[model samples]
Target: MTGERGRGRVQAVAGVVLLAWVVLFAAFVEVGNPLVLLATAVSGGLVCACAVAGGVVTMRLTDAETAARLRHVFVVLEGTAMAIFYLFYGFAFSVEPVGRPGDFAVVVLLVLSVPALGALTLVLWRSYAVHKIVVDAFGPLVPDSGAGVPVQRIRVLGTVLVTVGLALAVSAMTVALVTPMYRPVLLTVGLFVTLSPVVLGVSLTRVTDVYSARRRNVGNYVIVLAASGFAVSEFASGAGVAGVLFGALVFGAVVLLVIAILVVREFTGEWDRPWREPRGRKVSP
Candidate 1:
């Protein structure tokens, strides 16, 4: 399918999903005992709907100028959603009288917000405005028809920082899960996890279109790193520190392999061409 058509389908699906979530939250509100769960679900659904709506609006812009304006608006909407999640659940997770069910819902919502906001920002900015800006401003920095060496170096630095942060956070979470005395440490770890994505999001937006090939490579790396962190946290919680370390090592290895593959692809002329055909009007990129 064409990119525009695919985007339309995705927006439609997002709308349908948001509607279903609204209905589900409404039903739970009427029948559930824990008010916190109902409130959290309802708020989360509204935020998601807002994000989806922003995406739809962004997709409607056909020109680069209009798209840039819409992208700015979308970013503001995303920031608002992030603010709401941080203020509500980030603060309430410890003090709220919510039961385990409500607490689970809160945690899930917080996690979902990161990717939902990330995807929204990506779709909007990566379309044209941000892409053109990076391409025009840093075109000389990018390698000819390949992943730029400078961009790759920056990505490497980002990967290292993200890896270290994830490691420390996961280690803290594991200890908290295994020992009741470390619960405060776990809370701090959760805060770190929440903040890391926010920082990554801002950084990514600033460098969204630095190099098309490197963008995909960097995104893939981030995903692997995040998955690894989750695996380590879960394994540690379920088994022991040995299990967590082993899982983390495995994940780290997989990410390293992915990085190697990306680097090889860059050098082997595999990523020398545009991944997608340019469409509409060229905007000086």
Candidate 2:
């Protein structure tokens, strides 16, 4: 199928099946527990939102000839994932008789779905925006060997995301070192603790866009793994004096130290060269 028609077909797959799923759910299921009802409503909303967003972004792909490969990728990932997630929720909650094991499953799904869907939404939307800019500027002849990244490569969105990740990472480390007694900033620490993965994921993905293929994930891996270790230390904060002092403070500082060493290693070597030219700093391609 042509890209335009394919876009339409993908949207149909999302909208039609989702609408039907909601119908079947309402007709057969009984929600005696308020929590189950809430889970159902929230999950339904999330599934629909993700599907619509993925569809909107994928539809833009048809505007750029070079975007065909991207269209295929998004179609398969979004359509199949949303469909499967919805079905999983459906069968898991249908409750043959209702309310036996929902407490744990509901908690797990709710916690996981936010990041899962949010990450998926961000990727699709950003890809479309990038594709749209290139199609507008250079008539879709952009020579991209992988994904349709434009030559000009002006990446404001990516820079902002990575900057936020750095800010959160620094703030979390600072708050821990200053002691948790600074409860006012505890929320910020919690944010870093929870959203670090998403931040790191987006940041690293953006980092790769500029780096040489072989070295793309090297420095990013150190940053992400250190951040994750630091975040996981939060759970031990309740273990008393030793916990508060050693859990986040000592461990976090140690991880940051390791990160510093790795980053220094990344920058000093020629292995990490061919980095993206910063704005106005022309590099021979």
Candidate 3:
């Protein structure tokens, strides 16, 4: 309980800090329009709300498992909020020379908001179902199998991401092939995005069986890579052709950090055991 409280405090602090940073960033950009800044602030506030909500749920819940699932819900919410904020702002910066920021913001908001809405709906529906089941059960809902399990929910999310990413990647590649101004770096970005989801889906699927520690570690690394790719891609898009090398450099640094963390964890014996105790069985100490 003490640990939970500490984590919650940390999340609260993070939310405050993030809100501050967003306001500072908007001021730094010298955005002339008050509405643009207001929109940015609202997005930041939504993220802060998500972060604070996650911590509150974590602290308030007695059941660790349900709390864990709820945390995932808030995490998705935070990501979705931030993604929409970034996509709109990033596209605004990336728009063609003659394009107005107002027009770009409107178009990008519509484009990004649709998928975010669908993703949020799925997350909330699944989370509600899980909460209902767990609450109605006589004891802790030990998810040994089936779609009710948290792992199963993750797999479903992964599957959806992979399917959508693959389709988008294919379409992007087709356009790149026929277009004279196509950038290879953009294609690489699409491939990285697609690969991350595919790797995550495969890794999580494997974990459903024995839940190997190494497999989990690898999955974590893939998640880091995916996040790095996303951040880099957004920056690259905004920076134009000049950002290709910069994005690669940033990504390479992230990869090295992930590798170093893996090595440290391995040496500390963190990955020397199963991720979870075997179902319906016990390990002798």
Question: After superposition on all CA atoms, what RMSD does each candidate show versus the true structure?
Answer: 11.7, 11.9, 11.6
Runs of candidate 1 with Cα error greater than 4 angstroms are 1-36, 39-47, 52-62, 72-178, 181-216, 221-285
> What local lDDT does model 2 show for residue 9?
50
Model 1, TM vs. native = 0.37
TM-score of each: 0.37, 0.36, 0.46
Off by over 4 Å in 3: 1-14, 28-46, 55-162, 202-208, 212-218, 221-285
Best by lDDT: 3
Question: Could you give me the TM-score of model 2 versus the true structure?
Answer: 0.36
TM-score for model 3? 0.46
Better of 2 and 3 by lDDT: 3
lDDT of candidate 2 vs native?
Answer: 0.42
Tens-digit lDDT string for candidate 3 (116-147): 33333433333343344344443323333322
**CA lDDT scores, all candidates in order:** 0.43, 0.42, 0.45
- The better candidate by TM-score, 1 or 2, is 1
Count backbone overlaps in model 2. Answer: 0
Candidate 2 regions exceeding 4 Å error are: 1-7, 23-28, 31-36, 49-102, 105-163, 166-209, 218-285
